[model samples]
Target: MPSPTHDALRTPAWTPPAGNTKPPLSSRMMRAAWRGLPARRYDVGWEPGLVVPAPDGSPLITDHYFPRAAGDFPTLLVRSPYGRGVPWSPMYGLLFAEQGFHVILQSCRGTGGSGGRFGLWRNEAADGRATVSWLREQPWFDGTLGTIGASYLGYVQWALAMDPPPELKAMVVQVGLHDPHAFFHANGALNLENALVSGVGMAYQHQGLAPMVKATLRLQRRLREITTARPLRGAQASVVGDVPWLDDAMTHADADDPHWLGTSMGQAAERLDVPTGLITGWHDALLDQTLEQYGRLRRAGCDTALLVGPWTHTSAFQRGWPEVFAESLAWLRAHLCDDPSGLRPTRVRVHTGGDESWRDLDDWPSSPAVTSWFPAPDGQLLQQAPTDAEPLASFRYDPADPTPSVGGPLLSRGAGPRDNGALEAREDVLTFTGPPLTEPVDVLGPVSARLSVSTDTGYADVFARLCDVDAQGRSTNVCDGLVRLRTTGQAPTRVTVPMSSTAHRFAAGHRIRWQISGGAHPRYARNPGTGASPVDATEFLPVRITVHADSELTLPRGAAGTVKDRGQPRS
Candidate 1:
């Protein structure tokens, strides 16, 4: 783990031979794929495998990409644990470098031939400060800096923002995570699927392409067996190898637990004054976190912009990359290079579902109106509250046959919108359908459900989902939320579930549907009726849940009179 000598660090592993070279084929292909990108202004040159010392003197492997043309430019630092090859090099290093900025792509400690053990978020702050110290000594250093990245890369940026370097001028966090506890255990339930997927990626992706592919295949093959194991605690090791971090993450479900101290970087956003841009998808697994930071940054009187697309966590890098890249490039140029020509006029931009079109606004919601819909006894959703005194709907939820998850927000390829007809047909799921809409309903901002429920067992969970039912009766989920329940007696207890936010349209002739269930298995660890943590539970029990007529669903109405009061439910 010895740091390389200063003389050796100055030597590049590989560099361009002559002047005015053409951009790499990979860069050209990516530019073509990401159509409408700014024209490449300069050819890119890279010095790979340069050694930078971490705070503890561990050698952190790094790559430096710069424009071959002769002009000084601001530096963009991108730290990642996913290695510095394939997508990282072409997507962040060469592509940005060709646009006339110096790009530093460094593999986080212990991930890609770097010294020191990777302990999740433990070393990012110290390592990032050390990297900045190294940057200051370079002969080419120009004293200006910007940070940009997504996911854990975004976390690293926040780590640095804890004590932001003076040279740092701007930041762009895409589908970023500011709170690890919120990411893993939001709503008092473990996000089992996302956790497992993350564990696999962290443990294998840095190894190389072949090893990563093999591990992904194995995960896909054994996911069911692993998720449904009796004692779910150690079952994940079979698929993701020995991941001590994953075990620790799963074991500590409480956000207030001592194990989570110093893990959250949310305070950085609350007090930050750096001009920042945030991007995420309506269906991204980390959507809530991105939105949370955006609000905090705004409250702090910091300059910030927000963009939300109709995509999942992974798609934001693939099919959604064009928008993601354009947003990032514009923010970096405007803030770091003092070029605002590429910037859009609006502070908030979002992609609305159903129509699948983008909208630009001064800010989110645009002062929307709130509407309430009440569930009736006969599987009906009525705008007016029911007059019946004791109307009730009930269903039995058996952990052995837990309700299956069908799309919505997730990290796997199965993320985003999907047909939920099969899922709605289950006996354990209760659906209340509204009459067909005579006009399109434009919904924006937060969605929530206030439910009055009673369960046979004191320990349970309530999952609420909003869906759009087409003419063919196919239900597609829009947004959903789950909250764990603990009650003392048979009397119904009222609890409000935050279904997150959305910008969507329900077309004319389509009906709105409210789905209520005990749980969405795998997406959330199944709640055992015995009140034991799902990871350690060996016994499963069935619980009967009852929803009262007083339950209501609330949505933010983007347009006035968009929803017509059609008389009765069709289903």
Candidate 2:
């Protein structure tokens, strides 16, 4: 009988209009921003080193830049743990200031020149309210306040959004995390790489270390060695120096633990009523979290807009997309300054890969056509469910020889989507490849998989990745997930894992591939398979992992051809 893998390329390719990318800022905008603006109505004024008292009476440092020609202008507040004197201060301070708004760049407690112990988001809620109260006391206050920033800075906005101040008007949060557990421990496994890198980085910043020293410590090789060390609980102290939070985080694996609960937005997500704008990248580590925030705000009846692009966290920061930037500026103007020029027609805007185009949607999974794809014994993916009832493919997983971390949604090093050729070649990795697609398959929403697996070990972790295999045979990861199994009886266990969401088009002639492995070490700490704590486990237990033939991958498919904004699915 002819194999299912041979029946490839049966559908036609779907092509869409390419997105518009603006060139660098014009000389007019740059020159005017540097020197006093002549054509604009307001000139920028910079005021540095102002102190605001937190609720606990700790002094928080702030710098203000307001339009010289301002008359009761609204203000934009950015609370960041990173120093305020950096370029971010002047960039937004001058831009928004010249745009006729007051910009206050304040360092969170324990960062920059601020005089308080920084404990991540612990002090943010109380400190944020206290700062807003201080803003209201100012003679220049106009009762309209907005928040803006990305990453950690973005996180502060969400902290306040849970219980916003009376004077708050709008917010623009980019790539922020709503849940600490999702950010730190994804799917019951410690995101060892990010946790270690970020912990050491914050420690270095807190100690005011030299930039070169910080860079050397952030080196990938050094990070890999540290992450691969035995017992992750206290191994990072040598590099990071007594981070209680990191230690506590490693020990508390459960998301419901009170330690993790203190950092979560929880019911605050539903209480938020501010007009909000969200920005994220397809490869951003917090992409899923960002998307969840948008959905929650929308459901809570808040005016919200979402922008997603084909970039990584670092890329989005260093070389931001002009379209997204322009949209953000417009969002701020509309919500804070009451200017409606930047209003977007569609609430959700996603940049689809493959064709390199932008797609507007009403909501996520815009009319999804979910398709269930099954695996064959010979490493082929079929559209229909398999009939076999036995284990067709099996691999031996050794904690000592755990699969190395590769490109995906990681932080510091090896972050974002990358080719999986080398990773897929490992004996421990089992792949189910589909034949070249005849037509483009637009996958634009949540992706998940259900695996019928049996393992000899007491505990194991399953890592799954969805990839697009081009005609050249390069397998680039689209989305992936991890699920840790602590205990499973001898019988085959059925486990479901949800992968990251994305809007990508697998073009005609490209193949859809799925890779399964016991672990993506360092990205997630490897399970020792001994039912012992991974932190101190010293044994190298090799377990036989059997993936039953009936395992299935569920993909949320969008309209097949020429997708447009709010249009009917193509027949």
Best by lDDT: 1
Off by over 4 Å in 1: 1-34, 388-391, 559-571
Alpha carbon lDDT at 291, candidate 1:
89
What is the per-residue lDDT of model 2 for residues 123-167, given as tens digits with 9 covering 90 to 100? 888888999878766666666788888777787888888788777
Model 1's C-alpha root-mean-square deviation from the true structure amounts to 5.5
Which has the greatest TM-score? 1
Q: How accurate locally, in lDDT, is each candidate? A: 0.86, 0.76
Model 2: clashing residue pairs? 9-438, 10-438, 11-438, 11-439, 12-439
lDDT of 1 by residue, 359-435 (tens): 78777666668899999868999899867535389999999999999898898867888899999989999999999
TM-score of 2: 0.89
**TM-scores, one per candidate:** 0.93, 0.89
Where does candidate 2 stray beyond 4 Å? 1-42, 206-209, 212-219, 560-571
